[model samples]
Target chain A: MKAKIYIKYKEGILDPQGKTVHNALESMDIKDISCVTIGKYIEMDFDNISKESAELITEDSCKKLLANPNTESYTFEIVD
Target chain B: MKAKIYIKYKEGILDPQGKTVHNALESMDIKDISCVTIGKYIEMDFDNISKESAELITEDSCKKLLANPNTESYTFEIVD
Candidate 1:
């Protein structure tokens, strides 16, 4: 199975990377842009583990290091 | 509109970050995990531009900077 974690900056939080990307887009004359944000997408493959276990582990990873609790939020899914 | 660009390492590419995460998962006793891969997710907001133009700009951005043609692959979507 493969597990995917999606992490993104919390709403209302200032995102410098996103700002940079937005500015870059503007410079390219790709105007009309409003805001930009950046995030992380992580995929983990596993087998033989209970789905419950995978969920727990993914939750742990997201809460521990995969995201900064203060500024980032994450969600995950498991797939066969 | 909002554009999302998802960038991931090409298949068979070595990913130290994924390896590290895998090792960490193991250490946490969250075994059963086979492999891990990390990626970037970027969101760009825009207005007034035709979806066609937005698509072109997003493609150009991905080809130019959002992804490395050699080791990374990217896909994007525009949303309201």
Candidate 2:
């Protein structure tokens, strides 16, 4: 199975990298760009695990290590 | 319009961060995980631009600033 997880800072949090990206776009004459938020995309491959177990592990990873739930939100998808 | 860009290191490249995460997972007893790779997910919002223009700008951004074409590749999707 393969799993993908995306993690992003919560709204209203100050995202310095996003702000920098926005500014860079403006400098490049991309004035129509309004917002730029950067996040993490994690891809994982699993073997010898059932889909249900993969899902549980992913959820646990997100909560325990992949994201700081208080400030970051995460979503994941699993595929065979 | 909203655009999503995913940038990742090319295959065969060493991803230190990913390795660290793998080790962490192993330490936590998540041994079924075989491989892990981490990348950047960038989301941008645009106003007053046609879809074609948004696509062009996103491509340019990936080439010029968002990714190093030598070792990184990027893909994007735009939505109205």
Candidate 3:
């Protein structure tokens, strides 16, 4: 199975990077854009693992390293 | 409309961050993993634009700011 993970800052956390990009876009004349948020997208290939195992591994990895629990939230899905 | 952009290093380009994370996962004894890739996931909110305009804006933004065409490739979709 393959796993796709998305990690983003939790709501209420200030995202300076996002704000900077928003300003950059404005300066570039890319208007009508109200917000710009950036996050991490991770794709993992597993060696013939069951979906259940992949989910377990993905969750563990997210908690242990992929995301900072206090500030970031993550979601993952396992696919063929 | 909202634009969802996913940008990643081209297939031949080296992804040091992904490699480092893979190695870290290995050291943590998370096995059955063949490969890992890390990419940028950007979400942009546009102010009441038509679908056609959204597409054009998204494409332009990807080319002008969101992606480095020389070493990175991107795909985006306009979502409701």
Residue B27 of model 2, lDDT score: 98
lDDT of 2 by residue, A7-75 (tens): 888999889999998898778876678889999989999998899999998998888899998899988
lDDT to native, each model: 0.83, 0.90, 0.90
Question: lDDT (0-100) at residue A1 of candidate 3?
Answer: 84
Best by DockQ: 3
Per-residue lDDT of model 3, residues A6-26, tens digit only: 888888888888899899888
TM-score of each model, paired residue for residue: 0.88, 0.94, 0.94
> For residues B1-80, what per-residue lDDT tens digits would candidate 1 score against the true structure?
67878889999999999899888878877667788899998887777788888888788878876789999999889877
- Interface RMS for model 3: 0.9
Q: Fraction of the real A/B interface contacts present in each candidate?
A: 0.79, 0.81, 0.83
Runs of candidate 2 with Cα error greater than 4 angstroms are none
By DockQ, the candidates rank as 3, 2, 1
Off by over 4 Å in 1: none
Residue B76's lDDT in candidate 3: 85
Docking class of 2: high
lDDT of 3 by residue, B1-80 (tens): 89888888899899999999999999999888898999988888989889899888889888998899999999888899
| Model 2: per-residue Cα lDDT at residue A73 | 91
Q: Model 2, chain B: what is the TM-score?
A: 0.94
- DockQ scores for all predicted structures: 0.71, 0.80, 0.84
After the best TM-score superposition of candidate 1, give how far the Cα of residue A52 lies from its true spot, in angstroms. 4.0
